[model samples]
Target: MRLPSTAHTSRPWRIHGIAPDFRVEDVWALPTPGGPDDLPHLVGQFTEGEEPGMAGSSFAYRTLFAVRRRLGRLLHLDDADGGVGGRVASLRDRLPADLLAAPRGPDSDALPFRSVYLLHDEWAAELANRTVHAVLHLGWVPDGAGGYRGQMAVLVKPNGLLGAAYLLGIKPFRYVVVYPGLLRSIGRRWQETAGRRK
Candidate 1:
């Protein structure tokens, strides 16, 4: 999806020091196309609610919570009574603390932001070894401004070394570029969804 040029022209969001206060409400492993060892792999969402907006103003908090629940189930192999909780916990620990911070309101003292950490490490080396392409979509419910709603999707195709380095914390600069695009895509998707619903 192409984003609005105006959105691109503006200043981008930045993540300085990690948020001192944050919690991992949930996590899960994304399913590979075939089995557990597929090359193009993905992990589940670490946070529980909506993502940040393009203009850095608003978001859909509840929908993200619901998505995490559903992703949790999918990663659990549909066995609600099984090891899902453990899997989520394990993955949650690997995420950056800021990514797990509580969602802030548009006017709150906190900055409006959201993030996901994708890793291709020794534990899941197969994913890191391949040329993987990934995209994350976050549903949003715009605060007020009528019944309009939307979604934000971040698509990434990190080269093998860069991708692996990102997961390892050896390279953090790439996120600076990646996140703004994510915010923009999310805002556009939310706007389109809201327009269609009306």
Candidate 2:
């Protein structure tokens, strides 16, 4: 699904005060074997010793680039440009043809995948809480040593505030399994980063 433009003009969301009121069920991941790893480690590293959490924000941005590198390797996409935009273009080109050809559905059983980001406002909550958004990026990859790799990122913004992005990469697998726990772990890392902002 199309996401709110990542432009600076968008109103900043409020992250402080009340905890964000968002559901965990809405989060989803690409169906892949072995799912994502190092989630707790990532969160701990991000939250360790940081006062406000700016370190986590920096880590998220830097981590995205690292993920782009791994994605290039899995997809066999060249990263001569060595930038996020270039990496995404390469990934789009490498998606398995079958996934692109199949119709969209919850049970397509297809390996290739697409992603969506969900957003919710206080209208759905009791406290008139801050606007909350979740970024979900999903796609399929090979399995086993030879299988493809799938990767996705879930970013949350509270009260119109945007900070601390979270991402998870799935190893190659025949059947993809979306994990809610992993998403929550990622969201927490993002929150740590958001908390650090000045």
In terms of lDDT, the best-performing candidate is 2
Give me the overall lDDT of model 2.
Answer: 0.30
Model 2: per-residue Cα lDDT over 172-191, one tens digit each: 11012223334344455544
Model 1, span 78-131: residue lDDT tens:
242322232222223444565446332122112112233322211110111122
Error of 1 at 135 (Å): 3.4
* RMSD to truth, every model: 17.1, 20.3
* Predicted model with the maximum TM-score: 1
- In the predicted model 1, the residue pairs found to clash are 60-141, 149-194, 150-190, 151-189, 151-190, 152-186
Model 1 residue runs over 4 Å out of place are 5-95, 101-129, 139-145, 160-198
